[model samples]
Target: MKNRLMITAITLLTAMLLLAGCGGQESSNVASDESGNKTEKDSGKPKVAVVLKGLDQEYFKLAEKGAKQAFKDLGVDGTFLAATTQTETEKLINILEDLINEDPDALVVMPSTEAAIPVLERYREKDIPVILIDTDLKWDGKTTYIGTDNYTAGQEAGKFLAEKLSKGDEIAILEGVLGTDVNEQRVKGVEDVMKEKGIKITASQAADFDRVKAVTVMENILTANPNIKGIFTANDEMAIGALKAVKARNLNIPIIGIDGTSDVLESISKGEVTASVAQEPYDMAYKGVENALKVLKGETVEKSIDSSIEVITKENAGEKLEEVKSILDK
Candidate 1:
């Protein structure tokens, strides 16, 4: 009887431990489900994946910061990532594929080129929402687009140049990658206006938007065309590089660029660059995430959100910069 009692106690203890383990497992699963459903309380917020062209550019870095702030305010996850090169078509495809598999509710991407439509279609096939920034694909698979008006911004830059110059001034253009819409549009806009005013382009070269490359290319162009009166760049990093080359040569040509980064604005204030076309990158990031959240909630939003642009010259650079700082503070 003693042996039988001891065996019975052992069996009861085993059963109690098994029950406790099962209870603990069930509780853990329940907690996970609860956490997942928190966004469903009233205004549901969805996750956003921000895939940029590359991390080396100051413009993209600021964009990521703005996206992070928006995510915090809306209580959603904003996963920020970048490709090694802006033109890495395969890398972007793979990143999007993995992100889609994880089932993030939405994606925001700066399309590497107009040629990335086929990959974007795959995401559309999976019913994953997409937001395009900085650049866009030709096809319309994306849920919405948020970016600067590149053509108009370029036009403003052109106007600034026209005002700064007299008739028949020779200018050189340092272009970004050719096929990308941002580069193409901005270049065309400037050329269209400059040509209308009879401003002749002595040299046009593609720096591929790389700063170091821009410096070398600018140096070579300076060797070939020492009489260039004005220089226009597609982005600020390249603009800075060109400025360095110009300063090294002690040339006093007016230089202008796009993407109003802090460094570029500072350069404008210090007369390193003549001007820049300022795009609302922060607004693009904040609104892109906000729109993604709305889409995941099954709400209808505009297919495109256009942020305005401005021409930042030395005259208004200080006031405009102060205004931007105030906006960022809020």
Candidate 2:
């Protein structure tokens, strides 16, 4: 009877200990999103995700500001992410894959290259809205494409440069990524315009849209072709770099570029860079999110939304700079 009593006491202690251990654990607040990702418990807000090519440049920073502002004004649960650099195509693809598993209600992306199209299609299959900004894709899956008409921007910049030089005068072109669609369109636009104006393209080189690389590339071009009359760069960073090389050689010639970044606008104000075909990156990003919200709401959005472009010269560079700063400050 003593042995039986001892066994009963031990069984009772085990039951009590199990109860206490269960009580000591904390409650889980984590809940699954409608698409099965971890999310806040029953928040009425829609989940929106933005992924850019990279945020290393000032131009991309302006885009980030626009997205963040829309996030605040629209009252959605927003997540912004980016690749480390513009060239990190694989990293960007990986980010897209991870975001897909999250299954955001909508997606905004500035594609690094055409490689991102396959990953974006999965969003389409899942019925999640995809909004493309800056660099666009040919995929039918994209809900809408919001950015500048790059070819038009390039044509205008080429026209501005051609006006400063006489026919038969040779000029050089500073390209971005060699075979990328954006670079190709911009370069082709410039080339066709140059052809019409009877201007010869003496040197066409790719600096990958980097300022330092442009400096080195421009230096070599100047050494090889001393009498080149004017220059056109695919983007402002390359324009700024080329300017340094030209100044080093005491060569004064017209140079035009796209992307009316503050640095380029400042140079234009100083009468250094001749002009810039300014794209509205801010508007592109803002409208991207705005349209994404509409898609989520079952409202129709246009397939193509042109954010528009402008030509900034010394006469209006200061005003444009203030406009850009105001948007950034907000």
lDDT of 1 by residue, 226-296 (tens): 88889999988889999999999988989999988777788899988999998877778888888888888
Q: Report lDDT (Cα) of residue 163, candidate 2.
A: 93
TM-score of each: 0.83, 0.88
Q: Note the residue pairs that clash in candidate 1.
A: none
Q: Which ten residues in a row have the lowest lDDT in candidate 2?
A: 26-35
Write candidate 2's Cα lDDT for 1-330 as tens digits: 999999999999999999988765522434333233655633668878888988888889889888877877887677788898787889999999988887789999998778898999999999999999988777898999999888888899888889999999999999998767778889999999999999999999999888999999999999999989999999999999999999999989899999999999999999999999999888888888899999999999999899998989999999999988897773
Local distance difference test values of all predictions, in order? 0.80, 0.88
lDDT of model number 1: 0.80
Superposed by TM-score, candidate 1 places the C-alpha of residue 153 at a distance from the truth, in angstroms, of 1.4
TM-score of 1: 0.83
Query: What's the CA RMSD for each of the models?
Result: 5.9, 5.6
